[model samples]
Target: MPDPERDIASRYREHTGRKRTYILTGFVLLVVTAVLSIAVGSVDIPPQDVVRTLAGYSVSTNWDNIIWNVRLPQVLTAIVAGAGLAVTGMVMQSILRNPLGSPFTLGISNAAAFGAAFSVIILGAGSTSSRVGDAVTINNPYTTTIMAFLFAMLVTAVILAFSRFRGTSPEVMILVGVAMGSLFTAGTMFLQYFADDVQLAAMVFWTFGDTARASWEELGLISAVVAASVIYFTFNRWKYNAIDAGDETAKGLGVNVEKVRLVGMMFASIVTAIIVAFLGVIGFVGLICPHMARRIVGDDHRFLISGSIITGSLLLLSADTAARIMMQPYQLPVAVLTSFLGAPTFIYLILKGRRI
Candidate 1:
């Protein structure tokens, strides 16, 4: 007989090599996209100038200001937020053993929206300026961000507590999320109804996801949270893989399914909440990227997680860039573009019967 064991080993190595290549390709594409995003804004700087600026060479002061002060922050935000949301989606799907588990689906986004609206309306943190042609201004962005974060966390706490105290299944927790999302949406509408025109405009503007709002300090905070969460998921990748096999199988493999699930959910929720508080509701990247990565990298969390991070970053950054340059001086919200891009793809996946 032929050497069957040797053949198996060869096949395994080939498979691993292929996955690595895919990840490498994703990284390369992400780099190109980031460069294009930084270069092709209203004041289209040449690629060489863009590279020189990044390499600490002196471009013109105007070019330097546009690159460093305006476009670079948004590009960095897109990368971080995209990776954060996608990885968070991956963790939620793995822990819950549900294909549809994401921050958008779990009501976390809605809760954050409600909180921001509360700050704008009841807290009087939102106003409009006649001098700037009635441009909506958040009088206290910190208060709105804080309120959004707290409300998002509150929803997570409720879901965890119900699961722990009531001994409900992951499916039940999802149902609870649906209920919570509806309630928050109603609450947002309630506040909107009683608000004056200025406050209403401000509230509406806050919900439209835009990366330009984040400054260097805000980006630093988002980066820190996302970096820590990614590290945690990387360390616990094996446990997530075991859990994916089933709770009973995971327990036999010495994985604490309940504890791991709860902790993982909490971390994922925190990542989603922070992103939403800053960027508004950029949906579909989380829901779509994990599935796309799994199709390419298989169910192994090691490759799957890395794949998701790259895919998510590329997708969101590309969308944001398109939004910026499509209409020239007038920019559309990145969130609108994402929803438009994501909805059709999502429906197609469902039509193809993508089950977890």
Candidate 2:
């Protein structure tokens, strides 16, 4: 008869190997779905048209413009935002040792929203009807976006500062993050209340977050940032897992827990800023993806980070596609669809924590 312990170990090894295979499969799926995303739309462009357009071949001018200028940006935006948020979620969960720990947990999104709020409401200037003499006013979307990113870091810094002087207990961190989130969100609500109708409209769209404003320029900027972040986190995967074993153990094992936490938080904040600035605040993703990934990959960041990223990217892209197709002429907000799907999953995870 087969030894039971050896059989069990063999089965565990097989399961681990199987997860790695699924991860590779997921990457393939992400690429195929992304290509499909480019092809399926109101003006259905064939696969050849997509390839030829990339090769600078002549197509209908309008179709080419739509393909190169519109769909490409949306595709890239979704990809980067998905990947960045997934890695951020993984890092946060690892650091805090809590599955629910995310950029949202630290109130970073609320702070970013507050910054966007100030830019829209506090800086709303009257549009002069150019009666041949009046100069046009141009608001910088990039600047407002930069503000959102910076404010996220600012909130993170404050949290770190508070945590620095005091011992870092999980409960203390959670309480602080909750309090800060409440304060920033309250501030945002106040700004929204006094916002002019036009400004309010802009903020409402942003708060809900669609890819309506995604353009090639923003895509290029956001992609570069996301790529850099992925490289950093990707190479440092082992450090993330070390933190989960606690700081002292991490230190004895040659991991600089404080430095890792600090660097991890910085990269995590940067990812949050870029995604929010580019896609608006897409929620429940940063909260859920990491846990699901760990559950699948067994808490190894080396595989878990990559798995979470692939799974997260697929989840968002599929959601975005559904949003586009489901509403016909009008597209639903990407954030809305994600939250709808993500909330139930998050709740189930909470219920399933014991199993984890």
Candidate 3:
């Protein structure tokens, strides 16, 4: 005779164990990929030397400078940016109950781009040099970052305001986001049309999603915000889990649907704004990483968030590494590599009738 309760408990334990294993494996891979990113760059440094330099050992002045002054910062930026975007995407999808919801899909990226463009073109904030490569090496990045953050918040405000009257239906919210995105994109193009060559070059570089622009100061700010947001999300994981079961069910479970949606949107918007403002507009990581996470860990927000963070960090670190080495002395935009990688997978998912 089978002990049904005992059998059920055994299966539950197995399921939980599998999820933990997936998260642990994914995190280990993320660390390895980060190490590889630090080592494999335009100027190759051995993995051992890279580790030594990081630990405050003198591995030649030039090697130290390259590792400490350049590669390490970029690696940190990619890891943080990837984790932030991936988590934001997961939150957006959960709240909207739409598989396609992302910062890019919601037009938040376009809003950030417009803000950067406004800072460069109208405010005369960034470098006016004719050199495209020097665009990321701007003297006053704070102005551009502030502008991007403001505009991103503006977009969030618009969506929330509209949702008040129309109700927060998934289709309605997505449509509103698409419309907002198109408007912001058009505004960016308009700014570019009247800009001078130097300003135009700077604006163009700002849109390429390069991580080499990261400085220690910017990384610190981003780290603080992302850490806070992730903590908040973690605490509310059960609420999100309830919400994921649909609004009516969530309400029945005593979840405040509107409150959660509002707070989640604001938090996600802030994370997206900070990352896009600094790294330009890296797409696909936000949109695809969540789906990848869900596929691996199922719909449990606890495991899903952890998996998304690890997977996102891995994907961005790998893409950035490819961008650095693929063109030798000349680096391709990290955005280009991510797009190339993401587009194929995206199309394949759609064609295979995967739930996206």
Candidate 1 whole-model C-alpha lDDT, 0 to 1? 0.89
Of candidate 1, the 10-residue stretch with the lowest lDDT total is 128-137
Lowest lDDT 10-mer window, candidate 3? 130-139
Model 2 Cα shift for residue 159 (angstroms) = 1.8
Report every candidate's CA lDDT: 0.89, 0.76, 0.86
Off by over 4 Å in 3: 1-6, 126-139, 351-354
The C-alpha RMSD in Å for every predicted model, in order, reads 2.2, 4.5, 2.5
Q: Name the top TM-score candidate.
A: 1
Q: lDDT-based ranking, best first? A: 1, 3, 2
Predicted structure 1, TM vs. truth: 0.95
Residues 17-39, model 2: lDDT tens digits? 88889799989999888878878
Give the lDDT of residue 277 in candidate 1: 96
* TM-score rank order: 1, 3, 2
In model 3, what are the clashing residue pairs, if there are any? none
Q: Which prediction has the highest lDDT against the true structure? A: 1
